[model samples]
Target: MLADELQHKIDFKTKPLGALGHLEYLAHQIGMVQNTVSPELSNPHMVVFAADHGIAASGVSAYPQEVTYQMVMNFLGGGAAINVFCRQHNIAIKIVDAGVNFDFPAGLELMDKKVRKSSRNILEEPAMTSEEYRQALENGKSVVSEIAKTGCNIMGFGEMGIGNTSASSLMMSRLFDLPIVSCIGRGTGLNDTQLLHKIRILSEAIEKYPHIETADEIAETFGGLEIVQMMGAMKEAYDQNMLIMVDGFIASIAVAAVWKKDPQILNNCIFCHVSDENAHQTLLELLGQKALLNLNLRLGEGTGCALAYPLIQSAVNFLNEMSSFEDAHVSNKE
Candidate 1:
């Protein structure tokens, strides 16, 4: 089997057994993902999905909702952290206006996959209708398909939307059967009073819909436009057998939603890092995954993905470039 072959090849490298630790596993996983012993990362891209949440108006986030579009502009101008890291690592980056409230000028460089001005306030009603949810999923698939046509085989998911953490928290609570308070976090640095208010508001929102049992229902109830789109993109990437690098809390929730539907997709995903968000580590544990880094990152612009890209490259690099014990004429253990 290919798994056996990959493991044997990895184990024969000129080093103590398991000396390379997680990098060896990463190489094996990447080899499995690409169906090759000598796997190469090509045309790596980071897709940032930006949107607006109507629940942002309920004091869930520290930043105002306009920061969504503002950060998108910062991304376009090469001023965001994601841009800097992608530039440093030579990875291509694209921004998608999934459902931000503000409209950009014509001829903007980003992909215009907007489904609406913004999602409906989940505090009052579902964040999106079934039709809107489907559209967002289609938009996500479309964006990833375009990237794949360019021979990109590895990509990361990032998100930008005020109150998106709220959506993610709510989804986590529902999907994991955890309390809303446990899932809630101080998004964008909420103070004590603000955090308490956020917890109360999200708890009430959960009360409005107490029986969201399925992934689709949870998503439609609380998923942001970019979150749903990211879920779609993740599913599409798994279909194409591409390596998926998932970012922080919001991105992890997107993966969680996708995983709930199709459990097999987890094999293609490499969680980049655990964020400082309260439940991020818990979410990772529940998913039975570990992140590549933990830099106390709470910023959600695909920064973790970009920061961790080189390590992924290192994994592939050593697998392809390192000599075997026989090749290096190194003595093997008796």
Candidate 2:
């Protein structure tokens, strides 16, 4: 369908012009994405990439690194907020062990795609070798390819890793050329002194990489396995023409990395929320995009994906199911 035709359909939806606000835009976008005025959502999925970061030992985050594994178990056991929201929205979530520091028995349901126990400290060396980075990207592509085989077309990216916020902050600083202090934020509820310590640690870490400019250099220099993998997954999802849902802060950094690789990849992305993290709003504005919701959400385990799913559904429903003025036999504007 032509873009003008899609806009006409949205404008005649038995309501005032633009009465639905963002929903009208969402309906038009989805119609364009699917190349159908009556687009239907199917097999909505969320993937949470879990890893451990070396910077967790440097006192950047309030939570211990062990919480990464603990939360993986929480996701497996269906006891986390992502679980609740996905259950409510009928979206399936998959937890991938991108590079957590722990090992699980073979009987567990997790996808054992670990690249390493943990990435190397960014303050000392590159997070992962070039080969490892390539492998992580391929592993991510493999995961999404399998999901696509199952006919899942809509996907969201989430992440879990202690000290990942530090990685994200450093990435933002490098990507936007913004000051490190502007991108830093409290992770896992850091108190005043702990937040100050995080700032100091990240500032020192930034000094180690002075010449990193390209996307690959910035990503390899300071990315968690989960973040890099999420970037790959996002690229693959866009390649398949699937709808991409982006979660909060850490997850957004992964999306940013994908944007660096190919700016057009964003055409398929629906940013799920504006994270409560301080830098998240700034990053969103820099990208010239608006999220579907706010809710002051900072939890990263794809919670925004699940919460935003209903609104996406509403957009599809109105476009396909709601009658236009002619269909409803209502009078049109003279």
For lDDT, the strongest prediction is 1
Clashing pairs in 1: none
Model 2 alpha-carbon drift over 4 Å, by segment = none
For each candidate in turn, the TM-score is: 0.99, 0.99
Deviation of model 2 at 135, angstroms: 0.9
The whole-model C-alpha lDDT of candidate 2 against the native structure comes to: 0.91
Q: Each model's RMSD to truth, in Å? A: 0.7, 0.8
**Model 2, residue pairs in steric clash:** none
Cα lDDT tens digits for candidate 2, 189-283: 89999999999989999888899898888888899999999988989998899999999998888888879879988788899899999999999
- Estimate, for each residue in 2-66, the C-alpha lDDT of model 1 and write its tens digit: 99999999999999999999999999999988888999999999999999999999989899999
TM-score of structure candidate 2: 0.99
lDDT of 2 at 46: 91
Poorest lDDT segment (10 consecutive residues) of candidate 2: 29-38
